[model samples]
Target: MTYTAMKTLSVDYRLERWTGTAWVTFKMSSNNATNTNLLNATSDWTVMPGYYYRVTSIHTAYDGSTTETSKHVSGTVLF
Candidate 1:
């Protein structure tokens, strides 16, 4: 039996705020790894008192020949 490993892994983080009409990205950050399979990130931003905010993350993993990607969005909160 044989096993495989990913060549690279990365994530894109976006902080979004709900405007009166649509969601807008207020801040952004990212983390990546070239020799490992783990990634961690943290972000902090001040929000207005009467707006909704959330985080959206896009994760991607790639081997030598193939790539896989996924997206996750956190639950919205009012501040």
Candidate 2:
């Protein structure tokens, strides 16, 4: 018997700021990996005070025949 497998993983990050009425995306980043279980990414931004900011992350993984996706949003923070 023989088996073959192919795996792919990707993550996308977005930085949002509350613009008094709605949340707007200001910065974005993407990372991808193959046949790996761990992925790491980083981003930096200069934020002004007196505003609320948040981060949204989208993660996706695929293994030969199946694909899964999840999304997460962080709590707002004042800067």
Candidate 3:
């Protein structure tokens, strides 16, 4: 969602899916400074049912410190 830095940090956001064989990053953000925005219905991203996904953020501080965090969402289709 958001990365807070003491000063300025390089941040990247990615949307990944578990495709049974591997974890794939379908969408990614360019290098950003400060914070990241959320992907919503208007974001032009398609949501497929019966898949596991995660929203991950990787942040690197000006001091060369780095940390990563991720949030997961699960969905299933009713056939």
Q: In terms of TM-score, which candidate is strongest? A: 2
State the TM-score for model 3: 0.50
Candidate 2 clashes: the total is: 0
Comparing 1 and 3 on TM-score, the stronger one: 1
Output the lDDT of residue 38, model 3. Answer: 30
**Candidate 2 whole-model C-alpha lDDT, 0 to 1:** 0.83
List the candidate 1 regions with Cα displacement exceeding 4 Å: 1-5
| Model 2 steric clash pairs | none
Ranking by lDDT: 2, 1, 3
Best-fitting candidate, scored by lDDT: 2
lDDT (C-alpha, whole model) for all candidates: 0.82, 0.83, 0.53
In candidate 3, position 42 carries an lDDT of: 18
Q: 6-75, model 2: which lDDT tens digit per residue?
A: 3887889999999999999978999887877767778888888898999999988888788889999999
Against the true structure, candidate 3 has what lDDT? 0.53
RMSD of each: 3.5, 4.9, 6.0
Angstrom error of the Cα, residue 70, model 2: value is 0.3
lDDT of 3 by residue, 6-76 (tens): 33445566677778898788787645454333322213467677787766665544524645444434352
Q: lDDT score of model 1?
A: 0.82
